[model samples]
Target: ETVDGPPGARTYRRTLRLPYGIGIAAVDERPGTATGGRGARPGGWLDARLHLTDPRDLTTAVQRLRRLFDLDADPYAVDARLGADLRLAPLVAARPGLRSPGTADPEELAVRALVGRDRAALLVQRYGKALDAPCGTLTHLFPEPAVLAGAEPGGTLGALTAALADGTLRLDPGADRDAATAALRALPGLDDHTVAVIRTRALGDPDVAPPGTGAPDDWRPWRSYALRHLDVAGEPQPRLARAGR
Candidate 1:
């Protein structure tokens, strides 16, 4: 039951629940303060954001949030662990230098550079534009391989359809990222740009190799996402130091 409360700041959104259970809420609280400015906020069962301070903690947060939202009949300890595991801001402060910049239009760079303007334009118009809505921000959920694979010879959806028709661009979720990147690179008509797009955005791999490209220095785990940053920032994608490593 909510109908406006104290004459204070911040529009507190509260979800009532059993006393011992967690009552979900969010406030537009001021930085370092419990009070927040009064403003209407969207309400839902969940809210998420990348803190950008530490990668390991952020990854742990993702795992914990997953369990928190897991609706199985299992006991609530799963969610409690998430709460307990929530690392304080100070602890993360010491562990900075994580999560570099990210992508703008990885697809655009990949399509235009590798696939050529005409074909890339068609592919972007067909699948690239609508990818975000359906696939969300998750790179692994990019459009199907068949469509992209046949994007050239068949038009936009043509390559995709062809890939689907023939078994060349298998859309199996179980496909390995490295193998998928290799397979995408092997498919006909695909140049560096297009293959990189498939590997980084489609396959959710940051370490995809550009065709006939240069050295591959290690950026450790954030390779693909980091490449995405380079692509988005209009900077050249980083070269992999070791070939095929």
Candidate 2:
């Protein structure tokens, strides 16, 4: 349970990348109750307040939040598809409601792919935008591609930033996957693995099988979810064998 806002209440808060600017939102998780031998019913409503730098970005902010949390996914459908695979059936049974997590801003994910987490922290410390009203540890908005582009965030980073800043590269959730993959491949210093990762996490492509697993054709359109289940079940994922460990 979360520990902010009020006693006996759990609140989750985070910074979001809106179209015009950045935003911070706080949402409370209301408890669920079982209805007399029936399943539990969600109690609280999805009430969230977004504090944005620009008031006009409300719509964009909401859209970004939905993408960030992957609220659009149909868990039942995904589980059913992956559960059809014999090897994955058992794992799917073990975890009936697994959902793939996605990022709000594709550009930020691309930058993250280029610079590892440690370096990302350092970059944030040095260059990220400070929120007007800081919420606990939510001190800053991630550095934007334009901001990083101006700072010359190294070679591969530089190319990525330039592309992102100028719109040469698009990572929006609705962006064409094939085109995005091809564009990423054209950039210097990017490998197929990195591109695949971007496809999975940033774009929220549910069917991304890591390069060279020869994942069967049947797993199409939901392989990313399968990969997550395999990882959780300690099954061998040969495509990302070393990294998965």
Best by TM-score: 2
As a TM-score, model 1 comes out at 0.37
In model 2, state the lDDT of residue 204.
84
Provide the lowest-lDDT 10-residue window in model 2.
Answer: 1-10
- lDDT string for model 1 (1-245, tens) is 12233443343332212113222223332223234456644332334443322343544434333322331212233222222322212222322222222122233333444545576445545664232222122212223344565554555434534654576554333457666556556656665666665555444443544565442344334344334334444667444466474
RMSD of each: 14.7, 4.7
List TM-scores for all candidates, in order. Answer: 0.37, 0.82
* Backbone clash numbers for all candidates listed: 14, 0
Q: Which regions of candidate 2 are displaced past 4 Å?
A: 1-12, 27-49, 53-55, 239-245
Best by lDDT: 2
For model 2, what is the alpha-carbon lDDT of residue 232? 85
Q: List model 2 lDDT by residue over 1-245, tens digit each.
A: 02376643667777887767778887765654445355655653446778888998998878776776667888789888888999889988887767687776788888888788889888888899887778778898788899988997568888889988898888986688889888899899998888989998898898888787757777778888888888888888845335554
Against the unseen true structure, what C-alpha lDDT does each candidate score? 0.39, 0.79
Candidate 1 wrong stretches, greater than 4 Å: 1-160, 209-216, 231-245
